[model samples]
Target: MKTFLLRKVHITVCGRFKLNDMHILVNTRLLLPGRFTGVEWFTFETLRRLVKWHPDVKFSFLFDRPYHQDFVFGDNVQPIVAHPQSRHPFLWYLWFEYSVPKVIEATKPDLFLSPDGFLSLKATIPQISVIHDLNFVHQPEGLPWLTGWYYRYFFEKFAEKATRIATVSHYSANDIATTYNFDTNRIDVIGNGVGDDFFPTKEIPDLLELDSKPYFLFVGSLNPRKNILGMLKSFELFKLKYNLPHKLVIVGDPMFKLSEMQSFYSAMQFKSDVIFAGRREGSDLNKLYAHATALWFVSFFEGFGIPIIEAFRAGCPVLTSTTTSMPEVAGNAAILQEPENIEGIARDMYNLATDTLLVDQLKSKGTLRAQYYTWDKAAERLWDCINKSL
Candidate 1:
C-alpha cells in the first residue's frame, strides 16, 4: 500500500523535478567520527548503502565538526561541517535552526534526509525523518526536564513538517501517530539488523577475562527504562532460588539515572556475582553475546530491540520484554517476561538457565529469525522511503 502510494506520487513528483538534478542533504550529525550507538549504526549502515546504490544522486552529508575520513563513505559524497555541534539543548536548537538551515540555503538541496528523526523546522525542502520512538514523550522522567521539553516542542512540529516519516518498527509507527497525531500511512517501518559478526562462535575465546561460570548477558545502557534495577533484583532472585554458577554480566555505561542504580548496586548481597563488563563494542560485545547462556533485555519500551536480534544471531537464548516491539521482534524465538515483574523475570532467567531443551529450541528459532534482518535490506527500504518523500 505504501509502495503503491509512493510510486503513484513519485510519478508526479519525479515528472516535475528531474532525478538528474536531485541532490540530497543528509543530517549526518548522528554519525559521529568514532561512536556507533544504535542511531549512529542505523545512519552509517543505511547511508553507506544509499551512497553506493545511487551514484547518479549526490549526497552532501552535514556534520557538526571536522569529520574523519571513515565517515565519508564515497566519492560522490560531499561532507559539510555545520556549525554549533548540538551537545546541549540550546546547542541543538542552534544547530538545527541556524547552522543546518544555512547549509540548506547554500546547497539548495532537492530534498533533506534526517536520519535521527530531527527535521529542521526552518527548512523548506522536502524531508524524510527517521523517528525511532517517542520514548522521551512517553517517559518524560527518562530525560532531564528541559531535554524532554525540547523533544516535545521540536518533534511535534518536526512530525508535522516532514514530507514523510520512517520508523524502526510498526509499534513505533503507531506510538508516534498517537502521541503526535501524525498520519500512520505516511510512516514507513525500516527495522534494525544485526551484523554478520554477531553469529554463533563455537568458543567464547576467553575474551574480557571471564571466570569459567556460565553467564546470562544483559546488554543496554544503564537507564531507568532499561530496568537495570529489575535486572539486578532478578539476577539475585535467580542466584538464591537455584544456586546456579551463572553470573550476570551487564555491558553498558550508566546514563539517565546513575545515582539511583549506584545506591542499589552498593547494597545488594549478590553484588559480587554481577559483573560490570562496561561499554563494549565490535569483537568484545560479539564474543560476550556468543558465550552467554541467554540474553536478558526486558526493557520497559523499545521501538526495536537490536540486542535481541544480536543475541539471536549469536545463537543465544533470549529473555526479553513482553511489551512494545520486543514480542514483535522476538516473535516466538524468546522467553517473554514482563519488564517490571521481578519474579517473572527471575523465573524466566532460571528457566532459560535450566531448561537445556528450551534453550536449544530458542537458539534454533532465533538464528532463523535473525536471518530476516540485514543492513542491505533495510537500506533498500530506506531508499524507497526517501524516494517517496520526494
Candidate 2:
C-alpha cells in the first residue's frame, strides 16, 4: 500500500489525476461484529457498493476496535484499527477528536467520510459526515445526561465542521440546516434501504415460538423517543377495548430509560400479553415482520424509519407517526397516526386486527413503495456527495 503525502496538489481541476490515485478515509467504527443496527447497515450496505463499483479508488476504513473481515468488501480497501473503543461520551470525544486526527495526519487522504455523524474537528481535509437525525435535540430526556450533553455540545460543531453533509432523509437535512444554521444545499439525502434477507414469507420460521393469536410488532431500541410508554398505553387501551387475544410483541433491547419501560410494563392491565423479545435481526427479524398483524412504529421523531420499510418488504402493514421522516418514507402505504394519540394508535391497531381487506391493501401498497428505496441508489447518492465535496 503506497502512501501519498502531497497536500493540496493531489488532483487538478480541469483534468483530474487518474482515478486510481484517489484515496478516501472512512469512519467505520459503527461496523461492529454481529451488532447490525440501522446506522451500521447504512454504512455497510452503501460502502460495499462504493468499493465494488470503484475498484481503482482506495478506501481506508478506520475502525476503533477489531473489525470483521466481512466489512472489507474489496482488495482496493484497507482496514486500519485505531486505539480506544468509543463506547462512552468521553471515549467518543477522544477517538474522534484525537485518535482520528492522528490517522488523518498519517494517511493524508483526499477526503474523510464519517457515516455515524461524528467528525474530526482537527482535520484540515475536506470531510463528509452523515448526520442521521436530531433525536437528542428534540427530546434530550430520552438519553442519559452525559450522552445528551455530548450531542448537544459537539453535534452543532460537527455540522459546521463538515465540508458536506449526508443524512438519511430530507426531514433530517432540513432539521440539521435549520437547527445548526448551515447551508441546506451542502446536504444530501440518502434514504435507508432493505436488504434481500427481508422479504414476504409464506410460513413463519420455527425459531419464533408464538401461539395462534396474532400480534402487533414494534422494532427499535427501547428508548423514550421511540414512544415506548405511549405504545404501551395504546396496547393497554387496545386490550381493554377488545376481547381479542392479540399480543404486543416488543423486539429490541432496553437501550435507555429502562426503568421507565419497566414501570410502564409493570402497571399494565394486560401486562401478560406484551412479550419482550430482545433484539431480533437478519432472517429471524424478517420472520417476525412477515407474520405480524401490523408494525406499530409511532415514534415521536425519526430521521428514517428503517423497520417501516423492512416490514413493507416482508409484506407487513404499517401504522407509524405522521411526524418527521416517517410519513416521507411510509408515503401512502401506511396508516399514519400522531405519536401521542394513544387512542388513535389503539383504534388503528383494532382496525388492522379486524379488517382483513384493509390489511391486504396496505400490504400491496407497502411492497410497491419498498421498491423505491435500495442500497444501490443510496450508495450512488453517497458517492455523488463525496465527488461534490472533492
Candidate 3:
C-alpha cells in the first residue's frame, strides 16, 4: 500500500497503477438499511457508476454503521465502518466532524467527498460537498429550530471550506452561491437522474380499486415544506365541485407533527375520500404512479423534485408547484400551479381528469422529456468535476 500525508492524517492507496492513482473517500452516512429516498438513490447510483467507470482510482465508502453485505461496489471499492450508530444531534456532530477526520487521517485519501453536504472544517483534504439545497436558509420556519440553525450555520461554513461544491439543480446552485457569497465558478450543477424502475410499465393495470374510482397520488414525507395542507384543501375543493368518486392516496410515513396532520384530516369536509397508503416501495409505487389521475406534488420549495420526474417517466400527468425547482424539472410536461392557490390546483386537477386530449399530450411530452435525464450522464459529469478539481 502506498501512503501519503497530505494534511495531519495519512491516507493509504491500495491500488497499483502506471497512471497516478487517486484514493477517494466518500461519506455514505445516509445509506441506512431498508431506507430509500432521493438523496440515497442519487448517492448509491452515482457511486456505483463512478466505481465502474474509473478502475484506476481507489474508492472508500465510509459509514457510521455496520456494513450491509447486500450493498454493491466495484472490485477496487472498499467499505469502512468507523463509528457506531448514533441518534443524538451532538453525538452525530462529534462522530462526523471529529471521528471522521481521524479516520481520513489514518486512511490518507487524496480527495474527500461529503455527498450530504457538511464536511469537517478540521480536515486538510481536498473536499467536495454536495450541498443539495439551501432550504434551511430560505424557509427556516418550516423546520425545527435547532435543526434549522445547525444547517444554516454549519452548511454555510462547509461551503466556504470545501474545495468544490455540487448541487442537484441550477436553481439550487444559484441559491447556494448567492446565499453563501461563494463564487459560482466553485459550484457545479449535477442534476439527479430518475431511476430506471420509474418508467412506464406494460404490466401495470390502468385503474386500481381503492373503492371504484381512481385516486390522485401524493408521494413523499408529510412535512410542512411538502405543502400537504394545500394539497388537502385543493382535493377537498375538487371533490366538492366535481363530485369525483376517486380517493386521495398519500404514500409516505409521517415524519413530523403527526397531531397537526391528524387534526387537519379530521376537519376536512371530504375526510372519507382520503386514503393513507403509508410508505410503499418497488412495483407498488410504480403501479400507483401509473394508474393515478395525476401526481399532486405541490411543494412550496424543493432542491429538485425527483417525484415529478418519476411521475412523468411513469406516464402520469403531473400537477406540481410553480415554485422553486419544480417548474425547472417539470418543464411543459406538468400542470404547474402556485402552491398557495387552492382554486388553481382544483382547476388543474379537474382539467387533467376531464380533458382526454390534454392528458394525452402531457403523457406523450413527458415520456420524451424524462428520457433526457440518466444516471450515466450525471455520474460522468460528477467524475469530470472531481477530476478537474484534482
Candidate 4:
C-alpha cells in the first residue's frame, strides 16, 4: 500500500509542470561574493541565463546569508535572504533543517535546486542537486573531520531525497551511482561551460612578473588534492636540469593543510622562479589565461576540470591529468600527464614550452574543442532538465 501510494505521488509530481506558471527556489548561497569557485560559477552562469531565457517562469534565489547585488540577474528573479551563513557544521545542519526548509515552505516553490549537492530533507518539493564531485567520499582525509562527516552522512540521504541528480562528468555520474547505490537513469550529465571572459586578450599591467620570461601557468586552489606540491616539485626539476629561462606562475588562494606545503615551498632550489599570483578573477584571470605558456593542472581527482576549457577558450594549450574527468574533458585536445608522477609532469611541462609543433597542435585542437562548450549550450541543457522535472 505504501509503495503504491509513493508511486502515485511520484507520478503526480513529475507528470506535469506548466512551465510558464511554475516557480523555482534556488539555494544561491554559493553565488555570494568571495566564492566564485567552480561550483559557484556553475550555478551563477546557469541561473543568470535561465532567469532571462524563461521570462514567464519566476526564479527565487535563496541566499543563506546577506546577499550580493550582482547576484540579482533579472527582474523576473526574486531574492530571499535567510539566516546563518552556515560556515560551520552545526550551523550547516540548522540552516538546511530549520532555515532553508522554512523558507521553502513559505515560498511555496514548485521546485527546488541546490547546485552544491545539498538537499533539504525537510522540503517536500521536487529537488535537483548538482553533485560536482564526490571527493569527500574518495579522499576523506583531505578535508576536516566535521566536514567529511557531514558530507558522508547527509549527502547519502540527500542523494536519495533529490528528485534528479545532475553531475558534471560521466566519471562522476558513475561514481555517484556506484558509491551511493543510486539509480543511474536518474543522473543527468550536464558538462560545465567556458565563460566568455576567457578570450585571447593582451596581458595587463597586473602581472609584470612574466614580462620577458616564458612561464607555465598553474590555476587551482593551493591544496593537497590540487597537487600544488607536486607541481612545484615538477617545476623545480624542470628549471634545475633544463635551465630554461621560464618562470612558474601559480594562481590560486591557499586552502587546507598549507603549513607543510609552505615549509616545503620555502626550501625550493628554484623558488625565485616561481611566482604565486594569488586568487584572480574577471579581467585579471582572463589576462593570465590569455598570456600563458600553458595551463599545468594535474589534479589528483576532479568531477570536471573547468580550467581545461578555460585555457581552450584563451587559445592556450593545457597539460592536465590523465586520471578522472580530465581525459574526457581534454578529448585529444590537451596534453595529459599523470598527477602523482612529478617526473612525468616536469617532462610534459618542458615539452609544452620547448616543442613548437606540439604546442601549436594542442592550441588548434583546444580552440576547436572550446567551441563545442559555451554558457548558452549549458544553460539550454540545464533548462531542459529543469523543464522536464517540472
Candidate 5:
C-alpha cells in the first residue's frame, strides 16, 4: 500500500527465461494482513519464497487495500495499492475486472498470476490461475447467493482463458480439469503446506485451562460445507453413549449460514461440554493441535484440507472425510470417514479416545506424511508453474 514507483523493464529476448528482465504482475488481493485463511496462507507462504528465490525477477503485487510491510517479502516485490477495497461480490467484480486491468496496463508484465483464481478477463497478457477447488460449484448453499453466482459464472471462463492452471491436489486438479474440460498437461499440482512452528510438543501443555479434559479439535470456519452441524451431532452422540470426560473443542470463527448449527447446539444435551475456542493461531494454536486427542475435520468438501497436514505436522491423529481431496491429502495417515455418516464419525472418535496403539501408529504415519509438504517445496512448484507460463 506504500506509494512506490516502478519503471517498466522490457525483455529484449523471448525464447528463454531471463531472470533480470521478468516481471510478474500478481493479483494479491487475498494477501490480507493478520487474517491468513487457506488462500491467503498459500499466497503468503509461497510468495515469500518466490520473491526471495528469484530476487532479479520483479513481482508487481496488486492489492485492493494497503498491505503490511511484512508482506512486501523482499526488495524485488513492488506492492501497489489500487482503488476500492474488494470484500463483497460486486466489489470483487469491479476490482478484478476494472481495477486489476488498469494496474496490468501500467505494470505491463510478461505474465499475471492469480493465486485465488480471479483473473482479469480484460487483460491481454498470459495469465496463470491457481483454482484451488470448485467447492462453490459442488455446494452452492455454503456461500452467499451473489458470491456463489459470481464463482459459477466467471471461473470457467478464467480456467479456459488461463495460459496455465495450478491446484493443490490431484483430486482438485482432476476436478478442475473435468469441470472446465481443460487440458491436464497445462495444469500444475501444487499442494498446501505446513509451517515448522506446528511440530509435536515434547510434553502436553497444562490442561488446567481446559478443565484438565482431553478434547477432540475441530478447526476451520463454521460454514455449512465444513459440516459444523454434522460434527456437533457426532460429538453429541459420542458424549451421550460414552458419557466420557473428553470434550469437543471447536476452533475458528463462525462463517456463513450458522443458524442451523446454532439451532442444533441449543438442542444438544452436552452442549456445555463443547468449547468454542475461536480463531486461534501462533504458539497457542500449535499447542492445541499437539495436545489434542485428534483433529476432527470432517468437512463435506474441500479443494485440499490444510488442517489435515497441519495436524499431521503437529503429530496429531486425524479423522477427515473420505471424499474429495481429503483422502488424497490424508493418504493412509488419517482415519477417513464419510462426512454424512454421523454414527461412523462418532465411532471413530470413540476409537481415538480409547485406543493407544492406534494413536501412536497414526502419529508415526502423520509425521512421515507431513514431510511430503512444506512451504519451500510448494513455492518451488508454483514457481515452476510460473516458469512454464512464461
Candidate 6:
C-alpha cells in the first residue's frame, strides 16, 4: 500500500489505503436534536463510534441546520452547515436536489454517506446510501401520495447512481435490487445495532407506574404499515379469549393521519384498558421495555426491526411478524406470527404473558441473540466497506 506523510508529522494513506487517513463526509440531516427517530439514532450512534475509532481520518458532518454542541465533532471532525432549516416538504426536496450539490462540490469529500437513502444526483463523489426499507414502494397506500411518490421515484434513481449501497438487512437489499434493477453484488448488508441502554432494569421506578398490571408494549410510529389496527384488534380478541387483565401500551407518536387509527382506537370494548403513553426517551423507554410482559411488533413490512433487538436487550419477549425482514432479524428467539393472523397474534401474546417457562426460554435466547449486534461492530463493518470501495 502507498502512504504519504503530511505536515511532516501526520501519516496519510496515499494509494490503495486499507482504512487509513481519508476525508469522509456523512449526512447529518436525519440526526437533528430533539427529533430522535430510529434512523437518527442509527446515524448518530454509528457516526459517534466511527469518529472515536478512526482518529486519523478527517470527518465532516453535513447538516441542513445548526446542530447542538453535544453532536459537534472532536479534533479530527468538523460540522459543515450547508442549508437553512426548512421543514417544508417542497423546500426539503429543493435543498437535497439543488442546494446539497453545491455543498458537496464545495466540500470536495472523498465519499458522500447518506443514512436517509437518497443522494444528490449531481454529486461527483462516490455515494453510499443507508436505505432502511422500501415500504413506500410495497405499501404506498399507507403513506401520503407525495411521500410515496418521492420515495419510489428518488430511491430507484439513488440506487442506480450510488457506487455502493448499504442496507440494514439482506431482505431490504434484495427488495432494492429487484425494484431498482441494481446489481445486488454492489449492495452491502450492515445490520443495525441496539444501544447498551436497552438492557433489563432491576428497579421499576414508581415514576413510570408500569408494574401495576401485566401489559403488552408496541413502541413505534402509529402508521398504517405498522399494523397498529391489526394489533389493536388482536389485543381485543386476546382479552376476550383469555379474559386476561392487561392493558395495551403504545409508546410512539402518530406518524400519519389520526383518522386512520380512530376507528380501532374508538371501537375498543375495553377502552379504559388501552393507554397511549406518548414518546419516552432514555431510561424511561428502557424501563418501559424491561417491564413489559412482551413487545408486539407485527408490522406489515420492515427493512429491519430495530425494536425487536431492543426488546431482546431489555429481556422482554418479542412477538413479531414473520413478514419481510422481521423473521431474519428475530431468528428463532422471537415468537413469529403472520401479520394478518389476528387470532394467532393474540394467542402468542397471551402465552407470553402467562407462560413463565416460555418467557424465560425466550429471554435467554433473545439475550444471546442480541449479543451479535453492537454499534462498534457496525462501525467496523462500515469502515471496512468504505475502505474497500475506496
lDDT assessment of candidate 1? 0.83
lDDT of each: 0.83, 0.88, 0.82, 0.83, 0.87, 0.81
If scored against the real structure, what TM-score would every candidate get? 0.93, 0.94, 0.92, 0.93, 0.94, 0.92
Which regions in candidate 2 have their CA more than 4 angstroms from the true location? Answer: 1-19, 207-209
Between candidates 2 and 6, the one scoring higher on TM-score is: 2
Expressed as tens digits, the lDDT of each residue in 1-390 for candidate 1 is 011122111100111223456799898887765467788889988999998998888888887766777877776677777666678899898878777777777668989999898888898999999999888877777788888899889899999999999999889999988988898889999988877678777766354445788898988778788888888889988888888888889888777866777888898888888888877887778888988989899999888989999999888899999989899999989999888899988888888888899989999999889878888889999999988888
lDDT tens readout by residue for model 4, 241-356: 88898998898888787777788789999898889988888778887777788999998988898999999998888999998899998899998888889888888988988899
Taking the tens digit of each residue's C-alpha lDDT, what string does model 5 give over 122-214?
989999999999999999999999999999999999998899999999999999989899999999999889877798886655435478798
Candidate 1 positional error at 134, Å: 0.8
State which candidate has the highest lDDT.
Answer: 2
Q: Quote the positional error of residue 205 for candidate 5 in Å.
A: 5.4
Q: What does candidate 3 score on TM? A: 0.92
**Local accuracy of candidate 6 as per-residue lDDT tens digits, 257-359:** 6575788778788767888888777788888789889999999988898899999999999999989999999998999999999989989988998899999
Better of 1 and 2 by lDDT: 2
Clashing pairs in 2: none
- Candidate 4 is scored at a TM of 0.93
Worst lDDT 10-window in candidate 6: 9-18
User: How many residue pairs clash in all the candidates, one count each?
Assistant: 0, 0, 6, 0, 0, 0
Once fitted onto the true fold, the runs of candidate 6 whose alpha carbons sit more than 4 angstroms away are 1-21, 205-211
TM-score, cand. 2: 0.94
Off-target runs (Cα >4 Å) in candidate 3 are 1-20, 202-209
TM-score of model 1 vs. true structure:
0.93
| Predicted candidate 2 versus true structure: per-residue lDDT over 1-390, tens digit per residue | 332323321211111223467899999988987687889999999999999999999888888776777888888788777767889999898888777887777767999999999999989999999989999899898899999999999999998899999999989999999999999899999888989989988767443436767899999988889999999999999999987899888888788776877888898889988888888888888988999999999999899989999999999999999999999999999999999898999999999999999999999999999999999999999999999999
